[model samples]
Target: MSEEPTTPKELSVRSLTGLILSAGLAVVGLFILPVFRSFGLAFRPAFWLVLAIEAVALAGVVISVLTLHRQRTLD
Candidate 1:
């Protein structure tokens, strides 16, 4: 048996949800990091590096959302 393809509506909803969640998490992390700082680790270079990684992840999520929207519209 073969798996059925997902409809554009389903894909758009799922992708949009994922993008929002990812962006939310990144924003929350920015706010929470300063609240739990231990000996200024949150202000250190490594901390900023991790934040940069999260920013990149957020960008990827945004791209994915745009791609899904385009695909859904094309369908």
Candidate 2:
């Protein structure tokens, strides 16, 4: 049997931190934004910020999943 000739790139500390932050932002957006909106006190900027954060979090999740799939395939 033959294995892959190269190793996959490891995620850097900064990159991992950013991913964790993104996931946190996603949780805030998923859980908090609605409550704010429900209270009817949130402004336009808050809404936009939450949306942007959620988008970034979603992107991070997609990238992470794809990377795991690639690594699995290599294995």
Candidate 3:
């Protein structure tokens, strides 16, 4: 059977939530790489700045997951 083509207008809430979740994961993954290489710089202000941003990304991931759970229960 042929799958129906998905248009922007047809996108479901679950798909959008998944997209947000994926984006948050990617951000966290990319941000974490610098931490491993910047051990010497860990005491600097820049390291803490980056860590704060990473924490925000992590929060986003958590929120998106909760949103998915709510959607699943509603369905």
Candidate 4:
């Protein structure tokens, strides 16, 4: 019996950018945030910094999804 080969799809530029941004944010949230929290710095400027990063990451993901959807519809 012969098996068919599977091909991988390439990510668009926007998709790749969003993936990278989101992954970087995830790393910050997982590592940096906890460190700040452990040091009892959550009430300081660190809170605002983390909040801004989260908001930007969320916006990037949303924009990426919307653009990808529009691109697909246009195609």
Highest TM-score model number = 4
The better candidate by TM-score, 1 or 3, is 1
Q: Work out how many backbone clashes candidate 3 has.
A: 0
Residues 1-75 of candidate 3 have per-residue lDDT tens digits of 999974333335774676586676667666664675566554456556666766676776666656553322323
For 13-71, candidate 4 gives per-residue lDDT tens digits of 87767867876785676556667778777556777767777887787777776654322
> Model 4: how far is 12 from its true place, Å?
3.4
| Residue 58, model 2, lDDT | 89
Candidate 4: deviation at residue 26, Å? 3.6
TM-score of each: 0.50, 0.48, 0.43, 0.53
Q: In candidate 2, what residue range of length 10 has the lowest lDDT sum?
A: 66-75
Report, for all candidates in order, the number of backbone clashes.
0, 0, 0, 0
- Residue-level error in angstroms, candidate 1, position 67: 2.3
Error of 3 at 1 (Å): 33
Model 4 clash tally, residue pairs = 0
lDDT of each: 0.68, 0.70, 0.60, 0.68
lDDT, residue 34, candidate 4: 67
Clashes of 1: 0
Question: Candidate 1 — worst ten consecutive residues by lDDT sum?
Answer: 66-75
**How many angstroms is residue 69 displaced in model 4 relative to the true structure, after the best TM-score fit?**
3.6
Error of 3 at 19 (Å): 5.3
